[model samples]
Target: MSSVNTAIQLITREQAEQGATAKGSTCSPALAKGPWDYDLAEALAGIPAYGPGASSADVAPAATPRQGQLPEAYKLASDAELGERILAAKAALGDRAVILGHFYQRDEVIQYANFVGDSFQLANAALTRPDAEAIVFCGVHFMAETADILSAPEQAVILPNLAAGCSMADMADADSVAECWEQLEEIFGTEPDAEGRVPVLPVTYMNSSAALKAFCGEHGGIVCTSSNARTVLEWAFQRAQRVLFFPDQHLGRNTAKALGVPLEQMPMWNPRRDLGGNDAQALLDSRVILWHGFCSVHKRFNVGQIEKARKDFPGVQVIVHPECPMEVVDAADSAGSTDFIKKAIAAATEPTTFAIGTEINMVNRLAAEYPQHTIFCLDPVICPCSTMYRIHPGYLAWVLEELVAGRVVNRITVAESVQDHARTALERMLAARP
Candidate 1:
């Protein structure tokens, strides 16, 4: 372990030693917490930690080309100008490059992306582009990491801006996950396997670190997105007695709930506590191991918003991603991924309206695409996920210029070790899909 990691691990050990007896975070669960939670120092503290300043296996040297902060870089005039230049650079590189854009991406970058979809779709898309030498990810850092994990080893996945990351995904990490699993074992002995042996599965959402994906792969889990959550969960349940789902509790819970699992069967794992800080009742009856994490964006939607939207547009179908708070999802007529929302809207025979409770960009894009449908975000006011918004056109332009210059900026790479674990988790899910 590096010195910084050693110290952070010391802190965790110190806290574990003292229990809740020491200084506890007294802030309301409502206190705003997001991507700014930097535990880089803590990750460094873990035993067998990587080299200096490394938190996870991802702390690679600055391998991608520099763009945004480079002094001599040419200043592109407008978003359009940047797009033109990016296209020009693509032409310069010729035939070996492809771009993947997330549904939440800004219009400027999305227009330039060769493939646009949610994280699950992007992960699959990357795998199909085996011939491409480079994959430019026009999304958050986790999405890029997912691309790196999914794409062919020879194909390099590039993130235009290193700073673009998901705050929601950051809420859960390795140590927290490890603690939760240990707790599950304590309570349930071991998850029952097909041969009546014990099985432990760790499933991750696409919006997680490459190491987490590696962790999942290592533990016989699969990566999931809002789109394929149901399939992923089914895959997970079949291979193991239970699954330890990270980063998005709502998605895991909601998906499990949808699959006829009772609310009583799901237990929340609080990384900050002993035996995952799970309630006794939940532990005794556990079927799903839910990490105490949620999406700051989707959690903002409440049942009240759905009610208000329904009153405003009667007969409208309230479609939401399962990542939403339970109340909001319960109030909605339907819940699924971006693909589901789009498909649901398109399948409507009657002129329809929709109150979507996911990211605003996807909602707004849906609104524009289906003019026949009266679609609006469930959020009455326009609030975007702050971190996703950080990948503005300026950043996109800057990154593109570096790519065009035959230099990859913000290259996201998953170490071979972690990649093995993360992919195992994902494949397990794929196999379990009903």
Candidate 2:
């Protein structure tokens, strides 16, 4: 199994030579082009939109940051050239810079990463290299923000492409969440019950913005990752009568449902409507208020895909991310975080078939790594997380070379005011146990 990028290119070329019917995978032919093309287009559009991929359809908020055109030299460089330049730049930078790549990032960019994992894991990885002056996060905007929050004051967190922003994180803005919080406060009041549980406590998924995490901290809430959501939610429930989970509804819903929270008790909160489009009685009766936000990539996985996988491979073990819809999760044999999925595959003593539902990049990487097993993505299409695709090798080479010249481009910094509260919320999460 080739890397997803190589596979996409091969599929695209084969399709062109033998007609569309020749290829089983369905992905935009545009994906076959260099991501720098979309990068340039996004820079020219001057509007908020996730570039081409799974999240291209997602409507970005007006506040989404945009990236300027890459220097022509980088855009014109061949893949081999970019790889050499990145390596040369890294060799020059030595320990002064540590590159962190997310699991969803393309293989082209991930090859240069000193540390590769999910966002939370990468952030913690940065802490291990404290002497590094720069943390180059090859993920999205929110991830870089997280590294900035957790890293030492002197360390600067840099995103290779500023346009690499998470669509799910953008779904829950600071203002919209603040408005929802005010309404909740009015309805639930600030006082705790006789059992010492407050009316509602905000709980933000790690995929959310820093300001959202700060909001959680200010209101006695905690942050959670997909792996620890159950523990965090249980932690929240111990101190609050109801929990408000945000940014990715699927993760919250799936995790809450696993914890025995009923469907009726978890009401969806639409930021556009007053009272989150729910009656006061419903709000009062809710045990968990879910925000209307989701991961575009995870949203692409469905029960139909799972059914198809099972039909194709009778004994296949189906594993999906918790960020997928409840129906998709319920249909799968197991749902867990990226780490869990990786560990499950690693733990298998014998070769086995797997149908994974997550970003195409990570799934394809797994398939490539485990040659003995037959592993495939649930979605036949090759669409990856749009934002993660934004960090192409060209951008990586450019950022790394810039660092070699004592210049930092696309540095992500959290405001001091938001930092304290956000760190507090994250700290609470770190201290939480199952």
Candidate 3:
């Protein structure tokens, strides 16, 4: 990753020169500030361009759904025009609608949010807005699903763009998890030990589908966020001999390792393989059975990137989210959630160089917010969460304006049956003290 950074820096510098060339004439100054004009910036940065008519050469092919059928008029509307329209619609809705923006969302969309937070924080935020008729989630699919499960039945949860989904969440489906559970039951009998503890307990990461959350609830388990994972695990182990953690192997591994679980006791479950690629002995001895899934964005950070930041900036503080690979988290000065990272920067009284490993949008926003501290992303590549990027200003305006007209577009509803169990799991997570 460190070696790749030099190449990215050279390319970005060249792109900056090109951007300076066409600065005032074609490129809006707003483009210079992010909510990056992805097309132009990608073209200039030697990073392949994406979004509407993106070529095959784009660095990673855009797997996320195309932006929904936005009004043709929005395509021609200038940024100022869109901004005015969004503001007008939001004003029209008033307290009837509360917009929730995730940290990974573009600044343009985030600007209109009533509140902004990570998945767990946003869940709590949803509870606070019980008076609102609609909860417009400016994040991904699973997040909206969680909100639907937690929010009042009368309060509709809306996802502006139906396409905004989490890649990591999609990796573990409910059916696969169910099958794995059955196999585990066969290996480690459903009976409890002498202390009356169950053989194994299910602990799904919050970055998972609502169905998985429901599974956890039905089986006497709870949901865990990156921030509260350790506490949640402690809560789990009190009633179970072993734990089965899913959707993100890295987080489970990192957290369990901290709790003194040996490497051999933590086995990775690959769903495609028979018995999840584990023998009966491995299953019986396992303290934490980790599901093979990871965040593509966090997985990009490496030990090399941390080393490079240290070499380049003397005494630089490296902070990473636990979602990062174990080695990267091990290399960092500290590991914490998005809010943790924000508070760390806020608490820094002296001039400090901070290198962060997380989503680019949040890191960039932090750097902008805390100018006294030299904040920079470990990865030089101009990559944002591809799925979160799906919620462009156009989608936001479309959804809000629809609500203004007494119409609900892109509403996300968890089935009543699923919601019942999922809500229980979420409530358990919220109650667990960290």
Candidate 4:
């Protein structure tokens, strides 16, 4: 993973508290909301976070090292020079190339994107450009894989930085999931209920790999994004006795909890241990079996920070993404997907104060866009999505230049077998959208 050269300086919670106290003010009340278990500053350095039982030793596919040792020309070029080169390459390629960027991407990279949006929107954005010969994705690896699965076969999906990957996605490997599935079948059996619903249904979050999505589709399951998680789960329940949700425990738990599923009924699956460290009885009674996975950036946000923001600024509207822990999501004013957060601010007519609990890059961008409102991150520390920042302007320029030279660089392709099943899951999601 790589770090972005942005103007924002991310600090730790402790550092923020000390700085505030030195200014003759106190915001520690918010800091007291939850335990600051990890160093928030490490997020800016592009470090991934593992779940309770999952370790780096779990051994997923290694990330491509695009961030290491840039070419001399790119290393020496100024920001302006790189920006000009990117623009020139795009102009030369014309309609043959299309650049898609995630909202969490840096301004430098986002500026070059022909379409800028969240994951769901970017997936659909690729579909809208079938005439494009190449889709240059300025996001993480899985996202590019998704675009490849959804886009036309003639379209080449390229991730500018191959090293860019989701920490949460890496938590659940295909082999571990396969073993878990076998164990689950052994306990639950392959029979359907009286209503003709299967004993269990597999539901994977969009942040996961194409292979995982294919697994879900092959097993009569569906893929879900944060925006449509609730709907996808509802769809799953219609045809299954219980849902096996993976790659993002928080989203599954949060959505299930809201739908009246008790916390006691949601058991976490620790891939490193047998039966996921749970007894058979608990597994039998479970409604949503949560895989041990979480977003490092969202997990860093604490309720203490939210409470402190409210204490410092009166009537502050606190908003967060559903990927956050249930406690933090519950403590905030509202929770939704990234697009929802952006719209919430856009819909406000009067000047407002917002305390957002998501990535720092999006928060900072929103703050700049909505000058009328005082928008700041709930987490006083600056922690952008490390993987999202891996798509630097230099990489963007390099890929675009290659495309202009009648060459495709860093193209991502899914196997026909995997693509067929992954597309099935994605199509289910599109149709299941509320």
Measured against the true structure, the TM-scores of the candidates, in listed sequence, are 0.79, 0.98, 0.87, 0.88
Which lDDT tens digits does candidate 2 get at residues 196-254?
99999999999989999999988899999999999999999999999999988999999
Question: Which should have the higher TM-score, number 1 or number 3?
Answer: 3
- How close to the true structure is residue 331 of candidate 4, measured as C-alpha lDDT? 95
Candidate 1 residues lying further than 4 Å off, grouped into runs, are 1-76, 191-200, 279-281
Q: All candidates' lDDT scores? A: 0.68, 0.91, 0.81, 0.81
- Tens-place lDDT digits, model 1, residues 48-83: 211111122233222211223422232335446666
Better of 2 and 3 by lDDT: 2
RMSD of 2: 1.2
Which is the winner by lDDT between candidate 1 and candidate 4?
Answer: 4
RMSD (Cα, Å) for all candidates, in order, is 11.7, 1.2, 6.2, 6.5
Whole-model lDDT, candidate 1? 0.68
Q: Highest lDDT among the candidates is held by which one?
A: 2
* Weakest lDDT window of 10 consecutive positions for candidate 4: 30-39
Worst lDDT run of 10 residues, candidate 1, spans 27-36
Give the local distance difference test score of model 3: 0.81
